[model samples]
Target: MAQNPAGASAAGKPRTLAGRCGSANWVCVAQCIDVTCVDKCLAEGCEQALDALAQCAEKSGCGPDDSACVSRVCGKQCGRTFEPAPPSPEKETTDPCADASVGAGKVPEEVVGRWTLEAASIRPEERPRLAGQEEGVDVKPRPDFESALVVTSGGCFLLRTKLEDATLGRGNTLEIRSWGAFQVDEKKDTVQVWTKSGQAVGPVCGKPRVIGLSKGKFQRPVYTYDVEGDTLTLTAQTPSRQTFQFRRQTQEQKEQAE
Candidate 1:
């Protein structure tokens, strides 16, 4: 994060943007100022706007360090009186995975960390075609993307992917995120992931959509896995065979890479 420029108040004392917005709201405020007119509003002492942005960030479940979510969701309303449209009253549905358990399996010590996707291989016949491509074309090219996987010792995991679209700007890139519980069987060299929830968010030719995973139901996918030094390989067992290679990432490296 870049340091905010120091500004002077009428009392002739130097004040920073972080100081202007209380520490609790600083993260969202900083992100708002970066992509909107929140900085100017702050200089003019717009407390209401700042408070609204902070509230929006919290209600939307954005993490403290999630600048992208802040900018995307709260930026437009930063300098104005934010009036969120009331959500239509609908029946609340319970999430099946809210209390789903991984059940009776331990996460391997070597797999309990962050990993970055390094390479992937798929048979030519099973390769996925690019959007809008003609049929029967063997020109299956790998999509430009970055992905990260986080496996926890507590049997939980998160996978995040950002698919790059050359025609879209950085602010509107496509992102897929999923979180679930995983069970590893050392004896069988297999890992099973039960996806609790997943979502896709971004623009497709200027049309934005947020689609749920598999109609909001749970999915269990199993893979044969191998770990050698820092490298981890996962090969699909059924359907079409595909393999993915990942490299373990240190805390510092993960921070810098992000």
Candidate 2:
């Protein structure tokens, strides 16, 4: 019967009790991520999971401000783990550059530059077969497709891609561009992208149109990258893991700025 921040039920019942959930209930919600709570609910066959979650907050008796209860009693009893609390400032070193260098990979310095995608391929085993193709065929981007990844000095990255496919029709290609902040882990040889914003340019109803990306916040498991000579290869985990091979853009390409 009450309204919550996420809105209300069609029948005027509370859709979410988040506002009324005590600190304990909120703690359980955080831990339910990646857990088999839904499966557990199905097994129980009666919304026992929901009842358990609601009971967490109801029994805690902690006030809205008492977040400590989440860890000290509620979360622990609920068998959920919160990401470890961040180290206190006093416990952390005062070096400002420490944060910058911490995850920088073994050769983070090598990642800073303009790189152009030469090829992209997906593992055959993980992807569906193309029409008239064999069951295990690794798919590669068409020759006309163009992609570039530029990493600047201060952890900023820009990605641009263009593709020409028969499916889209003759003389028409789709262009996609996105920019975001990124962090590199040198030890892990990985990169993570965040805060992505971008747009797509393509034909719509026989005319060119530009449309913005609907995603505001984006992130994924760290992508692995390898560099050799002027070549860079980035492997990302998608529905099927994909590998994108790139080459450092030459002065000529930079000047042309396609």
Which candidate comes out best when scored by TM-score?
Answer: 1
**Model 2 alpha-carbon miss at residue 33, Å:** 28
Top of the candidates by lDDT: 1
**lDDT of predicted model 2:** 0.44
Q: What lDDT tens digits, residue by residue, belong to model 2 across residues 21-89?
A: 112222121111111221121222223433453356457776644545533445433232111122212
* C-alpha root-mean-square deviation, each candidate: 18.1, 19.8
Q: Which regions of candidate 2 are displaced past 4 Å?
A: 1-107, 124-139, 165-167, 202-208, 214-217, 237-241
Model 1, 1-258: lDDT tens per residue? 111212212212222343332221222122111111123323443354446555766676667666576556765543232111222133222232344363224688998888877765533343353445554332222354566677777777766655453212222344555667778888998888765555554543233545444333333557888889999887767554456678899879788755
CA lDDT, candidate 2, residue 142: 49
Model 2 sits at a Cα RMSD from the real structure of 19.8
TM-score of candidate 1 on Cα atoms, chains taken together: 0.49
In model 2, the worst 10-residue window by lDDT is 1-10
